[model samples]
Target chain A: MQSTITGKAYVLGDNIDTDQIIPAQYLTFNPAVPEEYQMFGKFALSSVPASQAGLPKGHVPFHTKDEFVSDYRIIVGGKNFGCGSSREHAPIALDAAGIEAVVAEFYARIFFRNAVNGGYLVPFESVNRLCDRICTGDDVKIDVENNLLHNLTTGEQWQLKPLGEVAPIIDAGGVFPYAKKVGMLKV
Target chain B: MPAMTMTEKILGRHAGRDSVQPGDNIWVDADILMTHDVCGPGTIGVFHQHFGKNAKVWDREKVVIIPDHYIFTADAMANRNVDTLRKFVAEQNIKYFYDVGTPRYKGVCHIALPEEGHTRPGEVLFGTDSHTCTAGAFGEFATGIGNTDAGFVMGTGKLWVKVPPTMRFVFHGNLPPYLMAKDLILAVIGDIGCDGATYKAMEFDGDGVYALNIEERMTLCNMVIEAGGKNGVIAPDQVTLDYVNARNASGKKYDVVTTDQGATFCYERVYDVTKLEPVIAKPHSPDNRAYVSEVRGTKLDRAYIGSCTGGKMTDFRAAAGILKGRSVKIDTFVVPATSEIAAGLKSEKLNGQSLEDVFLSAGAKIGQPSCAACLGGPSDTFGRLNGPISCISTTNRNFPGRMGHKEAKVFLASPLTVAASALTGVIADPRDCLQ
Candidate 1:
């Protein structure tokens, strides 16, 4: 795992559930097949409206895109991010779409575990006001070891909760590799 | 030593420790593990890849495999997922593999888990499906996990877990006849919002909770995940013990655990069930709840009753009690949760007519036991939202495009509320329709 990650932020609001991240319809493909697994990246956030014409009168925070943009590597989200189903595909899709880290005020417990165990992305929890300070396409630097995130665009800094026991698992590249390193796997 | 909650006690036992506190990270042995067709194939693949192709499972008998979702779909890819589960179950020599089209096959994994006796008090259970928390009604510490974590549990029978802080919910007074456990839970989720209980164990108990039957308790625990809770637990009582004793096939003695009187909780809430009204979660989110009266007369194109959360016999009975001799004004689909539930609908009767007969005579389409139209099946699925149709569903979620079409709107209610809405062609309060 990188001690510090620098990337552009893709901001999302509260309660961005697994369904919004990747719907159940897109989960029919067999994960054993690499070709099918590769399709998850394209389907990430496919539910977000591509244009505001049909959108009902409400606060719509996501970008208008049918496909995930590879440019944004950090997701800055409000409270309870990844709040629905226990589909690891949400994080898998995000990882495949080149999201290196997620900074949220809070995360659904299962998504947090999935992110850590999958070792595909880093889940950094910041203060509730962190999302208010950051915006889309802003350059952000996450110093994981120091428990801090710096927004270069606004010159604002946010404190991050240290990853404690979860840090080594993420560093070992997911649970399977960590298990192997700690001699949990016999083979 | 500090007093322990039920979740702490269960996890401590599984972790082989004298006691455990909130935020303690420990590796615990799972008492029962589950996987369904949707996530089973991926989990099986991961298990094989990491544990070596020829390695056997840690304990084939301890793992439960059920092909529930995507079983009845015409889509070849969906069918292939079940075929993969069938092949893996046969090869692994699993004892509790429920394959579709078999006499022993049950419908939804969550319902089947308890019905088949995989859940017990004072045990630690995990499943790939998020609603796996439903088994917490049996006084167990149960939660959902991803495919990879499930795969690890399959191979090793153990996984690492962090103890979560406990939140206590106490319900007092008598529950009104018109409202069901679904309404009570919806109110809880609404009060807490979606993220209020994140990473916390929600312990539901009180005089009102003790009054509910096992099935209704299941409904309450099933939606704890909707509020970002790690698990929902109710202490096992005579009602739970009776249900378990009647269903369990292994004859294993259960260690029932309860929270100490002085147990610490991060949060505490109280509700008077008598004062609660029938509630519905409006479109786009389960926590977007409103009173049934608030949305009354809102037009709906269809009404659906089925899913692991709401498709049990008790739910159907409540719906039948309201829909007797009345024909639906809109498209209505009635689905039983399992084959046993389907049989119960056929055998049980109201006014000398079987519940199934009443539904069929009332212009309701009775579908198979699989999770039909709940998770948004293939295009050919019955009762699937095709266009901009508005629906009142008994399913757990009403997320955008969750049932079928992205443009379709969904309102979630109890079986009685759904039946009432079906008769009026709009969202109607069950209390208004009841005699």
Candidate 2:
């Protein structure tokens, strides 16, 4: 919820689905329980490369090296990022992995809302070909108030759009807190 | 005032506004809310956390809980998921909880939503499952949301939403016997690619689309999410009215919303389905589409027909028609979407042969009406992808490891194509196998 932020970027390709974010195998534990919820953090994006222990044999567009730092604050992706499944787990996993925000050309509608409403991450819709311009391990700074994303490594900046009504919800930390603040919660 | 699409009309009505334009944000009342075992437990947890344990649901009768995905599996965790739903349903005194092992237990939330009279024309519906958009086939403005959104809906009976721009896909001319609704949708997805319709309402119309039966329409709408559509809809006609009238106990006449003539759209595309051939989405992505003839002779280890998308009685009949008097060379699995469908397969006959008999005689394994292999169940799930085998499935997705194994490749096809491929031990056009 910070107005200004800086982080390392982990770039990914198009259609990075919920399954790839958190595979079905790791979803066995209930998110309702605190102890089980922590399991999500440990296994976030664990199936990026299907060849990993329980994953299938397919190319995952993101980094899968065991030694790679999981704390990439800014994740960049192409069109329709988080395109499959309605699992908030996708955003939960990303947030658990310490992703502060996601910059994508477009996003699946449900995933966009989940990320904002769950207080998992801020989804910033960047200009086209933004993924090509941003490289992995690059230092990126997001100016929330100005709606600008600065690529400090490339010395380029991209404009971000206002989230409209979603901004207040995000500022409230999540849908539940937003509802409480707006008096939507009767109690 | 501008002419409004059905989606705009429905949302506007619910929002208590005269008209709504695309991108307009509004809060609307939800007529029905659905959740399944996979996400239902979490939804319930959030609902209780926000509303308190003693709080009553906004409307008990409007909420539906179905346990479909994790049920029927040997995995203890899967079973526990359903147990959690059962406890929540009991505590809430929910009337529409479809518990596992009950006679009324329908399979696949999408299919069950329509079968149990929950999906009426022009009603806004919401579910935790992504394919909730399938209900939009009944002329409703239904879309999928996450578990947390579903939780909020359960507590307040309302949701804030942005009206999405619509894309109209007009399918003209007569569809060929060799082709199905599945083929038409696949062709559209291929043309538009996976991200083509993101955040857009795909309104399917034209003679070719209206000519299809309710089941075929469901098949067409079920896969809209694959192309990143928020929802897919067909304006209600007599065919839709008849189906709803038969199932609806109240005998009430539901409003049928239609797109005004000359309604503005963000994009418009038309397809002459007569020229369309049987199409399949190749391994890895639903947008990787090609004609069945192009992929013909490609060897496959398995062929499957079942899911909310392809497990309807009509789909089984089509597969049975192709598999009649033939033995499948590859591992073939057939599943009905609901118990009613299962009963129909047992009782209904194709040329005096029951679909169950046709499949069983063709060396096909029949599974109970659950999402058996669609979501890739626990080990021992019938027809689950094991290892690096290639499969042609009627299921919507072909994403890697979707069917169970990461190495296993899946081709998304119609039931007829699947049956034809199972008989030939390779991908083959259904037309080639038809007598």
Quote the TM-score that chain A achieves in each candidate. Answer: 0.87, 0.86
Q: Model 1, B55-119: lDDT tens per residue?
A: 78889888999888777777888888888988888898999988888898998999999899888
TM-scores, all candidates, are 0.95, 0.95
Error of 1 at B298 (Å): 1.4
- State residue B291's C-alpha deviation in candidate 1, in Å: 1.2
Which has the greatest DockQ?
1
Query: How close to the true structure is residue B219 of candidate 2, measured as C-alpha lDDT?
Result: 90
Q: For model 1, what is the error of residue A169's alpha carbon versus the real structure, in angstroms, after optimal superposition?
A: 1.0
* TM-score of structure candidate 2: 0.95
Q: Which structure among the candidates has the greatest TM-score?
A: 1
- Whole-model Cα lDDT of every candidate shown, in order: 0.87, 0.85
Model 2, span B283-388: residue lDDT tens: 8889999999898999989899999999998899889989989999998999888888999999999889998999999999999888888867677677788678
Docking class of 1: medium
Error of 2 at B214 (Å): 0.3
